[model samples]
Target: MTTTPASPDSTMEAIGQAVIEGRAGDIATARQKLLDIWSTTGATGDPLHRCSLAHYMADLYEDPAQALAWDIRALDAADSLTDQRVQEHHTALQVAGFYPSLHLNLADNYRRLGSFEAATEHINAAHEHAPNLPQDAYGALLRTAIEQVSEAITQRNTAKRASAPGHPA
Candidate 1:
């Protein structure tokens, strides 16, 4: 019997298991594990892997700035990604589906940082990209979050969103 090596994405997903499971006690360890992989993958690694790692890494940070940095990294990676790469890793995924959530996260982070103008820009981008989202639960969630983040920016509220990941929902 032979065992095939785990693919990079499988390894990446394994490292993020703690965050995905919401294992409250293992978050710090998960962060370090993901960082280890990030160090290996570097900025020029596979875009899908970088995007997934950075996106998951963002959720582990309670600090808005820290999360914003990771989110920005994720978006940058997404910029280099193509639908073909996404499908190779995840057949259900399309590149267009990635933008709304990415922009929404940026908007939320900018709003939290009190950068209302930047937040507004991102939120509008999210809204504009929303039609690309599939009419599914994930899409619905992002749409709702986009609206919520947009409203928070309008109100000039810097408070963390209740629905935000790692926000002690």
Candidate 2:
């Protein structure tokens, strides 16, 4: 019997729900749901699903080391991803645009872990990829965050950024 591929739409919908739960202050439930979904994706499953799942999963943790692990997984899946695949799921999405955010998160995680060298490396990577980001508000936000992380690195401050998405604004 032939196997049917998992639908990206459904995967994205589930991911979205988990993100909403996390945003609504139900991080434990959201993290559990995403973990359940991640079991299906595995390390070799869909790159898009792995990337999105790991990226959000990273945010659910207050521990920098834990976030770093998930962010690394997100970055690895992103390295395996393609613009064509991303565009197929969302016409407006370009894989190039994903690098900036991925690198920024890695930078932030590393900074919080007191790995300033790695944080600088990732922040630089984020800067290099920033031009691929659109001029929209989301892009602006990432850019501002990149700057914040970079400044924090220079200050050798290992504190979590106030502007970070997972943090209370």
Candidate 3:
């Protein structure tokens, strides 16, 4: 018996699942697969495909700088999408509707890089766009994550300011 190969969409989905569900030991392989998909798709691939690939790729990096680069790419890909393209991909969410989560991820990435100002900007963008998001499991989780990250960023910035010279304790 022989099995047919998975389509690019299925393959990408599988890679995304592995990255989301896999343990730390599994990341290297998942990252390589995601990279292979990205090489095939390039910048001109389906906007949804590029967005998904870039979004997952961001999580595979250990370095915040590298992750930020991928996050920016993901946001760009998302911005390039049209409502028709979003429907074509059957993503169950509109193109504009992805901004909140994308912005949230950007905020997290900026916070990781110690750019609190940039992080705060993205956090505000995320909150502004969040109401358009679908009421799905992932949407709820992203909302919760955004709230937690926003609070963490605020706390960190406060601590940093308090530690600075000549600042009142």
Candidate 4:
């Protein structure tokens, strides 16, 4: 019997496998393999996969801003999918609700880029989302830890300003 043609899901699965195995080159190659098929079919999976690949690649590119763009694209692709998938992807992801992982990543990016306000915003969002996390003894320790880090950074800067040579105490 003749073998059936591979589907988009299979292509995505391959890409995921490559990604999981820490084979960035293979991941990109697998993604490109599906790109041609998507281009021919004009399949919606195109953007979804592209967004995913781009997001991963962005991190590897050492550019947080680019990563954010890819994340936005992923969100847009999820929104544009069929009603059922839209609900499953978009609704479940909760654009309005805080997403700890995304927020944490964004927060770190903002911090590195010296955008303290934006970093704090994401940190706050993360805390809001994970209000029940456990810390050493107190509840929601992760949230507390994040807050402490953000606050420490801010406070250190403030103290630096006050202690600057010839500056008033």
Candidate 5:
């Protein structure tokens, strides 16, 4: 018997896993594959699928500016998803539950670019919604990451002030 082709959702999940697992070498190739899927889905694809594609796409970039763009797109796609649509993929989709992590990532992206204010803003947003996240390993990880980033920003700003002229060390 011939094997059946994978469904779009399955294909998207596979691609997302590959990216998360950090497949060695030629990340561009993997990103291109994601782009192909994205092209097929366009703006009207399953919101969860679009969000996943954009979220993973953000990680593939070395430049903070580029990554931030993808992050924004991912957030937008997530926001566009309706409660009914979310329920459709709820078993496989936690887009609503992922807001904290998404904001944390966006904060990190902004911090890397030395945009401390924006980073702090996103970090606050992450903290605001973090309590809603399930108390699972992934949720714990995101919470820890948010705290780490927040501390880093605080230290960086303090150091910057200390080094400025007329400021006490």
Candidate 6:
């Protein structure tokens, strides 16, 4: 028995339309259809489709954590495929040997999760990696500097609390 392969573009378009129409059930169905096609047919999958699906999952899925997971998956999809504009693909890609924007994302995620030390670490990495005016839109260097400065501020406050020994004010 033979099965027909799905048209990746068509499936993506349907998913996009479903999202646009606010058909939550249909959108989920279409997204799952694409996932099934990608998993079974080995399609590279459309980065934009994954991004849109991620947004849909984030906005409509009723779970903040799941939404974040979908967002990360979207980023993963974007990273997996490549074109002439590699910079447009993933912020984590290194250019001139630095990726401050990616690090900043990492820092912010960590900060939100209350991992201040890890956040500070990545923020400092962003500063060290960027260290100068960035020429590209990523602003990797500038992002790193900003996050590093913010991490420093957090560190100072933490140290103050430690010295006080009774209050964290």
TM-score versus the correct structure, for each prediction: 0.90, 0.94, 0.78, 0.48, 0.77, 0.38
lDDT of 3 at 143: 78
Clash count (model 6, backbone only)? 2
Residue pairs with colliding backbones in model 1 are none
**Ranking according to lDDT, highest score first:** 2, 1, 3, 5, 6, 4
Off by over 4 Å in 2: 1-8, 167-169
lDDT of 3 by residue, 24-113 (tens): 457777778788888888988877788888887877766668878988989999988887765654535477678987898788778867
**lDDT, candidates in the order shown:** 0.84, 0.90, 0.73, 0.47, 0.71, 0.47
With a 3 Å backbone cut-off (N, CA, C), the pairs that clash in candidate 6 are 126-144, 130-141
Number of the top lDDT candidate: 2
> lDDT tens string, model 4, 35-125?
4544653435555455444444434323556555544444455345453332333333233222444465456556656677877887677
Cα displacement (Å) at residue 142, model 6? 4.7
Clashes of 5: 0
Pairing residues by index, what is the TM-score of model 5? Answer: 0.77
lDDT of 5 by residue, 14-47 (tens): 6666575435645767778878888888877777
2 or 4, greater by lDDT: 2
**Which regions of candidate 3 fall more than 4 Å away from where they truly are?**
1-25, 157-169
Q: Write the per-residue lDDT of candidate 1 for residues 5-73, one digit (tens) a residue.
A: 223567556655746644565777888888888888999998988898888888888888999999999
| Alpha-carbon RMSD of each model | 4.6, 5.3, 8.6, 11.6, 8.8, 12.1
* Model number with the top TM-score: 2
The residue-by-residue lDDT of candidate 2 on 1-169, one tens digit each, is 1223334588878998999999899989999999999998899999999999999999999998999999999999999999778876776777889899999999999999899999999999999999998888888999999999999999999988888877463
Could you tell me the TM-score of candidate 6? 0.38
Candidate 6 least-lDDT 10 residues: 158-167
Which of 3 and 4 is the better model by lDDT? 3
Candidate 4: where is the Cα deviation over 4 Å?
1-8, 21-54, 74-98, 131-169
State the lDDT at 139 in candidate 4: 33
Which is the winner by TM-score between candidate 1 and candidate 2? 2
Off by over 4 Å in 6: 1-98, 131-133, 136-145, 148-169
Name the 10 consecutive residues with the lowest summed lDDT in model 1.
1-10
lDDT of predicted model 5: 0.71
